[model samples]
Target: MTTVNRSARGRKSLAALVCGALAAGGLAAAGVTTSLAPGAANASSHREAPLISGQPQYDNTDVYAFVSPDKPDTTTIVANWLPFEEPAGGPNFYRFAKDARYDIHIDSDGDAQGDLLYRWTFKDHVRNGDTFLHNTGPVTSLDDPDLNITQTYDIELLRLRNQHVISTTKIADDVPVAPSNVGKASMPDYAKLREQAIRQLPDGSTAFAGQADDPFFLDLRVFDLLYGGDLSEVGRDTLKGYNVNTIALQVPSDHIRQSVGQPVIGIWSTTHRRNASGHWTQVSRLGMPLVNEVVVPLNAKDRFNASSPWNDADFLPFVTKPELPKLIEAIYKIDAPQEPRNDLVSVFLTGVKDLNQPPNVRPAEALRLNTAIPPASEPKRLGVLDGDNAGFPNGRRLTDDVIDISLQVVEGELLGQKNDLGDAVNANDQPFGDAFPYVALPASGSNGPLAQGQGGGNRSQLEGGSAELTASAGDNGTLVTTSLVAAGAGIVLVGLGLAWWRMRRRDGAVL
Candidate 1:
């Protein structure tokens, strides 16, 4: 009894500290800025943490949940992994880690603990290991014999109450995974392959697992001395050509909600990889975008990944008093929101009341969505900030401009200080699909120049072998294509960078 009381008191104190940090100030308190300050931002959890960055196959890069637009009665949850995958990366193309358990968790009763979970376990196969090619010929279908490598997955649905598993059911099995978009020659009709991969489960839900263009767009050059040292290099989409392994599920709205009375639900995704001792250890976790990237400090990053939201109290200090805004204040010389930022708490931990917050909500990091809300007729990229409640902070959508919205909110936009802070990059490089599995098609390998050494080029050759790398014509004068790997080798050429890379590589699991 005393312990419960003490815990309650501690929570109240923390809430008070956060709520009182930002006094209700008007436009006057927020100094007028003639020109909006350029903000520093990165891809939503793409290579965000130290440990997960090294294990891309098990990295939960981004998660999106929104009421399906076409099928308004259903909701879609899209989670991505293996960030920064080169489209032409063959010889050993990327696939979901067979030894990892990729899971999507849902909290229906606002307990900060998942009441339901969908688990995916993969099995990789090689039809012809004798050859080095991903595919021997044009891959017209998912089961084409020419495809040397393939993967199939099974899905299990687990129902939990108070963190104790009540039941576990196998929802899907032997679902073919959509192969990577190797190129035109290998996968001449990739769309048909993706369509074939989509499966209708025993439950009234749709599932798809495959490669897709990374939907989250932002200038990663912010790490380049905060954008070329003066914020000048901001508009280029750093992840333009990259792809990610995606797991997209669309389920009936009523399936995930606690009850008709309780419409809001929290969603997050995690990746657990089997260690050497045959123990499944969680290595990556993601809920809200940028929480791991900008909010959590460097020291507790790995710990945060292994933690569940029910125990988020240990991470309260990071959310209450974040470090990104302080760095923004220091570098850009712009006043940041006051300490113990309750506004952020409202956004990240607890859902905004009268908006997406569930009943008796517990403060934790998860993407809260009001299942009752319908899709917007014309979705606004700024989301709720732009008066579109059907978007982010209400369960993110594919087209939500989270970078600009996060920047503005971090700069005190919600606290009545209207600011237009942004990173200049507006939208994704590729267009998203209009239906289920809304992410864009993965970029093809035949689109650009081959990687440095792959194209018969070397530093020893004069003029960097530009002559050998020229475009060629195939049979009947048809243009032959190759992919360009924009390998930024300059960063590794520096002495300090080399040391940092070696240290980070040694710190995490190499595979």
Candidate 2:
């Protein structure tokens, strides 16, 4: 805000630019952690708006659409909900919104409107209500006898023409959804349990719905310091140890596309919950991460999420005159680009030209994926900026470091401002699978590293518990499961008290 502050920001802006240019070019495999890595708040759409934040299950967390590596002929679309989930969540765990309709939209014609809509509606089922335990026995399978509380869902694929549903087909009905990774006792061999939930659809497609580690990672504390921390010394990735309910679909390229249509498709995820009038009301929408989290002002965030992309023109001023750069300059002394920021508009609204853009596509918010591009053998998490067209803004891959890419974008990466700007957390807590439904198994409840209280041993139980939830991804430590055992013991104690009271009442009556 002051001249002195602006002077410092100017220096930072130039320094970050130099660092970005070098990183953009060929750099060492163990390259220096770019100085700008911790320069901005790299965030996702989890609880980004006021209204949607209240509806965690209906709130869209992250949307990813990438070419399937195992089956190149197919495309994978994944949408996650119930963000920032604690693996140790108790008696009442997370589930899908039965009252809402979740959808993944594809615009093969590049009109920024869905040409084909894949919708999901869920049903909650309690196998038995007499017991407090979620699982009466070990969950050996998707339909395992031990699983007490469960849920089922049906998927519908609808083709839209002229904004009216032309045809609707039930893709899968009464499909099983895998239970949360409650703990070893409840869900032993989560990997095998996950397989049973991966059902093949009648339309030559596949579906998976259940819990998975929260894929979006970023530094939450950096926002406090105006994002000026060193790459190696910034905020910790708070997203670790969290879980989310996910709905993933793998379909042939032609399923959502006409054989003669465009290869590039615009993808986005949205959720609608029924109002008191019994009419569905759009509550949340997400494509690119942090669009509403940081870009939209507080008052307009809910409206932005509820409105359609066709009305995006109303919010263009925020993208063009972003407040992030001004905040950086005011707090940390860096000058943002002058107004008329075509870069922000293009990146958030329209796809980047010649790289990920659809031909003659109208500017709108959606993750654009070019189906013709083959998946990278060893993908670059940094995305197209790193010469890997198979990742992020080009359709998000599970391995992509969206936080880093987003931080770079925050500092005007598209406007030629390049820095290693990021939260320093480069990968997800879990490793992705090689097959369709590629998400890694969810973090277990009672055991594994992320469970509460017990410095639980290695995340070796699942794939992602690599280190302290707040520590670096490469840092390894043992996770203790003391809390789970304690929790089990506490349940037993409560049950014993009830039984003793019942006996006491009976004896008193006899006397």
- Indicate which candidate wins on lDDT: 1
CA RMSD, predictions in order:
13.6, 12.4
lDDT of 1 by residue, 267-321 (tens): 9898876654456666678888888777777777766777788888888898788
Q: What's the lDDT for all of these models?
A: 0.78, 0.72
Query: Candidate 1: minimum summed lDDT over ten consecutive residues — where?
Result: 1-10
TM-score of each: 0.81, 0.80
Kindly report which residue stretches of model 1 are placed more than 4 angstroms away from their true locations once superposed. Answer: 1-42, 448-511
- Index of the highest-TM-score prediction: 1
Relative to the true structure, candidate 1 reaches a TM of: 0.81
